[model samples]
Target: MTAKVLNIIKILQPVVIMVVVQISLAGVNILSKLASIDGMSSSILVAYRLLFAAASTVPLAFYMDRTIKPRPMLTWTVIGQAFLCGLLGGSLLLNMYMQSLVLTSVTFVAAMSNLLPVITFILAICFRLEKVLLTKAPGSMKIVGTILGIGGAMLMTFYKGIEIKLWSTNIQLYAHESTSTNKQDRVLGTLIALGSCLSFATWLIVQAKLSKIYPNPYSTTAMMNVMGSLQAILFALFADHDWQHWKLGWDIRLVTVSVSGMIGSGLMVALMAWCNRTKGPLFVSIFSPVCLVVVTLVGTLILGDKLYLGSVLGSIVIVLGLYAVVWAKSKEKESIQCIEEKEQGIV
Candidate 1:
């Protein structure tokens, strides 16, 4: 009986961990939105966040080096890959995302981000890393999901239906501030957010290659953080010449950077790596919609964000599409695993 309980706990552990990760990510979005509203520069925030991430993760990487045997020697190729990963995933992606958050509502950005996996799938196909078995259910589902996701995003972007009045907490954190009310700003923000998603998808592809080369998650992440910090610092310096924007105080800005760095980058990275190893990427990816739901609820209730009919319908569609792709991917993985087992006479 004890062994059975232990087995059950082991099986459920990844699910619980993923739920926590998604909630933590939702917090990051909320804090980032608040900080942006409070006049924090997104570029500067990215720089500081990556700096803190590097500081917190580098020590762990060194510790991992000491404990793990047969450490791969750091090479120029690894350094180059890390640089690209940092550029695409950390500095570029975060800057665009935060900038879009500044220009748009938190819920909008969160909902749009649900397109990441679909975008990644398309990119993988372009890179020839994934095959197109159109006749197969998995392949057909991928294409269908891609269409649904893109269509949902378009609906959210071009169509603003009547506002849905959800119950509000009447507690406005950034009561005085407002997101961009201008139509141009919203359109620009949506485009930038899509760009960030593309950057993130490309990063995943590059990181996959980097993983094959380096294989040390801790050290690789640390290097990426370091590279991202330097790049973001340079970019922020160029973008914002005002020294006042660089200053951090004991306020939302400080809290945002610290929490985003420590939790979003440091702890989440470690937890996700563990989860990925244990339960695969599909398991981790499927939990993304939870973050969107959390953000929508929290934003509407606490931040006084208004929900539009189009946004609601689009988010639902995107989530359905996300599940379709994840299910298809799982089926593909199972098929491959089955083939491997059969070849090995384990089936």
Candidate 2:
């Protein structure tokens, strides 16, 4: 009985970890949105967030290096890859995402982010890392999922059918600032959010290659965060000339940077790496929609974000499509594993 309970706990461990990761991410989105409303520059926020992430992860990297046997030496090639990872994932992707958050609503940004798996799938095919076996059910489902995902995003972007009032707390975090955005700004924000998704997809491809070369998760993450901080600082300097924008005060902005850095970049990365190793990336990706749901509820009730009919419908469609792709990938992996097991038995 004791052993069975232990086995059940082990089985549920990944699920619990992923739930925490997603909730932490949801908090980041909420806090970042609040900070943006408090007049924080998105670029400056990115810089400080990455800086904090680097600071928090460096000790872990050193500890891991000391404890793990047969530590891999960091080659120049690995450094180059880390630079690319920092630029694509940390600096570029985050800046665009934060800027989009400022331009758009938190719910909108969260809903749109559900497109990452679809974007990654498309990118994988483009890079020839994934194949298109149209004759197979998995391949067909993937194609179908891609269409649904893109269609859902488009529906959400172009159509604001009706406003749905769920429940408002009547309490705005930043009530002084106007939440209304012009249609042009909304369109631009949507485009920028899409671009961030693409950047993240590209980063995943690069990170996968980097992992193959250097399997040390903590060290690799630390290096990427350090490089990303430098790049983001440079970009922020050019983007905002007001030296005051760089100042950190005892306010929500400071809290936003600290929490987002520690939770979003540091802890989330570690959890995701562990999950990927244990249950594969598909298992991790399946939880993406949870963040969206949590954000939508919190944004509506606490942040005073409006709920739109199109967003509701579009989110549902996107989640359905996301699951389709994840299911297809899971099936493909199972088939490959089964075949490998059979071959091993025969040998």
Candidate 3:
């Protein structure tokens, strides 16, 4: 009985971590939206987030990972990891995504985030980290899953069906429905969101590679945050020359940066790196849909964001796709394990 309980706990550990990560991310989304409401620059917000994340993680990394002696040859992988995670994934992705939320609804942005896993899968295949076994069950499932996920994202992007009464409280949508005033903005937001997804996917792939070279998830994530903070600050200074926008006061902006930095950047990315190291990028991305669901409900309840028919339908499709891919991966892992067992004469 004791051994069984331990086994169950081990199995459930990642699931619990993923749940916490998703919840923190969902809250960060809402907080970011609130910060944007007060005319805060997304770039500045991201800069602060990275800075805070670095400040928090650096000490922990140094203290806990003291045994990890860095070698000179590891510089290249560190550079790649820093660029991918800090500049492209952390700063650029967050800036674009937050801006997307400004123009689009939270659910819409969250729905688009489901594209991360599909994109990551494709990148993994490209990098030869994953094989495309078209004749195999795993390959077939992945293909179908990718198609379904892309279809769902497209549906959510292009189709906003008749508003659902309870959640269609967005003033922007009401104003733009007939006038089509923000159509351009919406298109731009969608494009930006796509870029964000792609950037994040690339980051995940690079992170996986980095894990093999560094083998210290906490230190690696801390370095990425530090690098990303510097990159973001440079961009923020150039983009917004007005120093007025950088002010942090006793308000939602402070809360936004604090929570976003501490939870979203610091805790979430570190946990994700650990997950990526253990389970690969696909596993890390599989939990994105969970974040989406939580964000959808939270957006509707707190922000009075619209719950479009298309969003509901697309989210369902995306979730189904996520499950299909997960099932396929599990089967693939089982088959590999069985082969290894037979080879070792343990079966």
Worst 10 residues of 2 by lDDT: 172-181
Model 3, residue 72: what's the lDDT? 31
Candidate with more favorable, higher lDDT: 1 or 3: 1
| Predicted candidate 1, C-alpha RMSD | 2.0
TM-score of each: 0.93, 0.94, 0.89
lDDT (CA) for every model shown? 0.86, 0.86, 0.81
List candidate 3 segments past 4 Å from native.
67-76, 167-181, 342-347
Ordered from best to worst TM-score, the candidate numbers read: 2, 1, 3
lDDT for model 2, please. Answer: 0.86
lDDT of 2 by residue, 172-217 (tens): 7766433344888888898999999999778767776777778877
TM-score of candidate 3 to 2 decimals? 0.89
* Candidate 2 wrong stretches, greater than 4 Å: 1-6, 176-180, 345-347
lDDT of 3 by residue, 14-91 (tens): 888888998889889888887787779988998998899899999988887877556335587577777777876678
Give every collision pair in model 2: none
Q: What TM-score does model 1 achieve against the real structure?
A: 0.93
